[model samples]
Target: MDAFSEELMRSVEEDDQEKASVGCGPEIHLPWLSQHIQNTVSHGHKGINFAQTTSICLNFIQEALLKHQWQQASEFLQCYFQALEDFNSQKRQVALQNIWKLGSAILYHHPKSSVETFSAFADRMKNIGVQNYLKISLQHALYLLHKGMVEEAYRNLNQAESWRYGEMSASQEKLIKLIQAYRGLLDYYTWSKKRTELSKFDMDGFATSAATQDMHSYFRQASVNLHEIIKIPGVWDPFVKSYVEMLEFYGDQDGARQVLTDYAYDNNFPSNPNAHVYLYKFLKKEKAPEDKLISVLKILHQIVPSHKIMLEFHMLLRKSKKEEHHKLGLEVLFAVLDFSGCIENITAWRYFAKYLKQIMMEKHLDWVQEGWSSRKDWWPTFHFSYYLAKKNWKENKILALEKAFTSGILLGKGCKYFMYVSKQGHKVQEKSIKTMKKFVMKHNILDSKEL
Candidate 1:
């Protein structure tokens, strides 16, 4: 058996032994217990403690979930719901919050059930006069959108927009704005698809049709709403992206660029990394100058050094023949390895090796060696340096010997294969390799194996 299965079996056996020692009987059938508790709660069984029974059912559901017994857990969940149905109005409000948490965990594993669960939950919330029912509708709409049910998602959003639950509180007001933003996004999606369909058949006919007029009206409304929405500083990525797309489609390139730039520079918004990412992507799409792209990426890099896109930017910098650009590319690669969780990126390591080779080719040996000294703590430097030394041994014997010796000392047993001794048995080569092996034995760096 695989290690994981063996470990799981061991753990289960240990747990059963512990339970037996504690006088707990054999495992109860969770599905049967769940149905029994649910029947008792539903039938209003006399003398049954509601709180204690509810707690026990919830505990069984959690145990079943830990065991990955989804069917049994689902049964226990229904029993918990039945118990909650008996709660008084004030208690029901608090109980609804707990149900949302538990329901999210259960429903996430069962998408087919989630559709019914979300609908039923929304109905329950609305019947209770809960203001968050609108938010729930919006969440349901987003889920529908993810499932590619655009028409259904639009219906949900439209229904939510019509909701009038007394005076709006501060939180509800924000929720309304979010709902409107989504509505605008849905309109954009619908309009874009219709336009694509019409363009393929009769563009002139579509331009003057009622559908075109409706699309224009939708566009105007979305543009106005998104303008106001973005003016209030926040990370409004979807709204901003939709707004920019609509503007670009309508032949407003300058407007789109301005919107992207303004969002990236918005001081009121907490420094959002995506804000800068949006601007960088937009500028790149526009075929902006290298300097402009570099400047924007520099800011983004400072905000999030580990961002994956930084690697692409590093390649862009490497295209330039300028020494400064090459140096910048090296720095970018180092940052990506150090901070981006890409420590084992072979492409990056190979790129690093190539860059060092270029520097070694162009600069004086003393200068290159000085740079190597500063970066000695990083194993890739020594690892790649050894390969470079072996490849160019005939042209630069002195440099090759130095690199081989240092790499052996730092790389330990891993560097043994890279240590080449010619059949000619040059005394200098033999002496250096021997000294390198001695250092490898005495001062080995742990886990410095080459990639």
Candidate 2:
């Protein structure tokens, strides 16, 4: 029954705006405020006292300068923070988040760090406990990983995982498991150059298992991605290579290789160098003609000469073509020139440094004149494999993986290699996953998902 309401209604009816919105609301003026000041002096109200009371601050010299009174909008924020204490603690929490929005408007794009206000908010986060801990820790891990402090990220991830598990919920446990699995894959690739010897805690095993379980379903769902890879020359690109590698290790090389070859030309599979690793693995597993291995290496060199591992591939290639076993052995010997230094010698480190592709390609060849040495150790072997691959020191660029995987034979590190190598195993029918499998468990086998 205010005159404003009567006027607004009459205008709405006249303009047929009753059904349309103008997006305006009723606000009060001072004399207008006294008329109903008792009814509405809520924060946003513009009562009769509004102009006068606001002027009190405008009138003050020292205080007006504090806010650059020209930007009266900023004062709204001071009023906002004051209003929050009136609510109970829970609503007080929400008020703090809104405080950001309030500052966002008044800050006029000047990056204002309300450190004083944020400190209180941060304290609230700590008070909230476990849920907040997991969220904050996970975010921190993401930050560390983004900054390339992968080790720090994993450490923080461990803290987050602990918090999640402490919640004692099976659902939460699965979530943590999946996330850990994700981190493991990243960690494995990030540490691809550290193949000298795995850490005491076994980060290698952790990575492989995570990929196997979490990503097994990815093969089927990843078909679109696989098709893109097929467009590349050589039936094997990273995806196909991984698929074929996995199948062959599952005890079916011929079958995998056949399927891979069928799709080889259709999918633009690189028959020469890209497919060399699977071919070599298959050639070794099956008693195929040695000439086949030599042909692959020859094709490898023709395509890429910078391959540092060409020497190692030469060992296999020369031997494979030789009809007589004795002649083959001799040729293989000369092909592999014995560098005078050792397991950890600067010479070996040179190859390791030469090949480092981000993904593991292995060139672990550690020798000690007459005996074995740390140069051949699993971790360093992988580290160097990656290093040499980067240098393209071998024509059979992919063959660098041969020395890398084979070196794992000494310490039984083959399982770790198998995890990666098998992903591209030749046998598709055998290795092709039919449906998404749940991450059941983990073991030392390269067959399982560790990443």
Candidate 3:
């Protein structure tokens, strides 16, 4: 038995009779597991064959597990462990892939069993160095997060960061950043409601705002990504706060409030992003805001006092050291709401609205609705209420669409102002110009001139 051919030893050890699998052997290939047992199954000798092929057995099992072939994985596991008594350290290290797969399978497909499998993986990981293990660790962290294993995932992320030296590629770094972003953002009020951990991996790639805002940016479709990023556990709070301040400095009140209220609310809530989103669309339709969203939001305050964006702006400015933004906030709000949505930050919106209206009782800027009847280029988002309240929406829809386009053009132009907003659910830019043209034609206005 000791004198058996090396290849024969391999085959004999594996108990696989597919002689065709024979690497460099003199014998015909044997495929049937039973035949290997029969040919080499002399009772005493049978167990030795299984021992030598432990690596192969484990690999087969692991592949099955990764593929979600749970039934096959179970069978492979049975066979693999039966032969485990003889596997050496070298064989074990060589079989790490399978071990990782098993860990992943348990965590993702069979959560109740994951604790044990993950413990096993941990032991295996300790024996290994940080080379290939980092990737596995990162994946494990992501899975743990998904399974609501927050602390474990946090520990793993720290460890993963340690391994993130100068060796990783840019793509790998980006992926790691995404993982951090994903893990950080899960702490938002919305996601925490279920007490479920967010996935660490960006399976949908929504974590880091892309280099260029795609169809899913917060800037384009405010509410969704806004909601997504604020909850993550990373340094999201500071990042969002700093970012909103920057938008405010840049005169992007709509942009800032989207961050403030929707993504991460500061104490002075800007109002839900919908207020900014809808009101901006109305102003933008009239070629308003004219590249300065801050000024645009101000005028919006003049015409529509109860506008949510201006309310948030008033809150932010109320604390301004310069007093410019604060005074401006009141002026704009007074002009826009016809004094409807007033609020004293030192007091609150309720008392302020009442006092402001009592102070200036001329009808709210109901006159701003004058030219809405002549609205020419509003399509795609023609909700029934839109046509019913044409003046209300004419400026909002046009400006909203323009800001959407400007954001894209700016990103493509590689402005210093890229990534100021999260871009989620932004299907405004179709990949195919032809498709957009066809859509435009289908929604042609009554006048060809409007087209």
Best by TM-score: 1
- Between 1 and 2, whose lDDT is larger? 1
Error of 3 at 423 (Å): 50
Query: How many backbone collisions does model 3 have?
Result: 49
Return the TM-score for candidate 1, rounded to 2 decimals.
Answer: 0.67
lDDT of 2 by residue, 17-127 (tens): 432356433311112222122333555655545334433322332243355542343444443343244335565545444544333333332233232223323333323
Residue-level lDDT tens digits of model 1 in 1-451: 2232234335435654776799866532223246556565568656668776777787877887788666667667655654545547565455555555565566656533545445554555444435557777787788778778888888988888778777878888788788888888878777777677767657455355776677777788788778878988788888888899889988999999999989998788878888889889888888988878888888888888778888877887877766677677767765665643664454565565455445545553343344445565754553444445455466655445554544544354565323552221456677765654565455433335543
Error of 1 at 168 (Å): 1.3
Please list the C-alpha lDDT of all candidates, in the order they appear.
0.65, 0.40, 0.42
Model 3: lDDT of residue 403? 27
- List ranges where model 3 is wrong by over 4 Å: 1-95, 119-123, 126-129, 164-176, 186-451
lDDT of 2: 0.40
Assess every candidate by TM-score.
Answer: 0.67, 0.26, 0.30
Q: What digit string (tens of lDDT, one per residue) describes model 3 on residues 233-257?
A: 3334444643443345447777765
Clashes of 1: 0
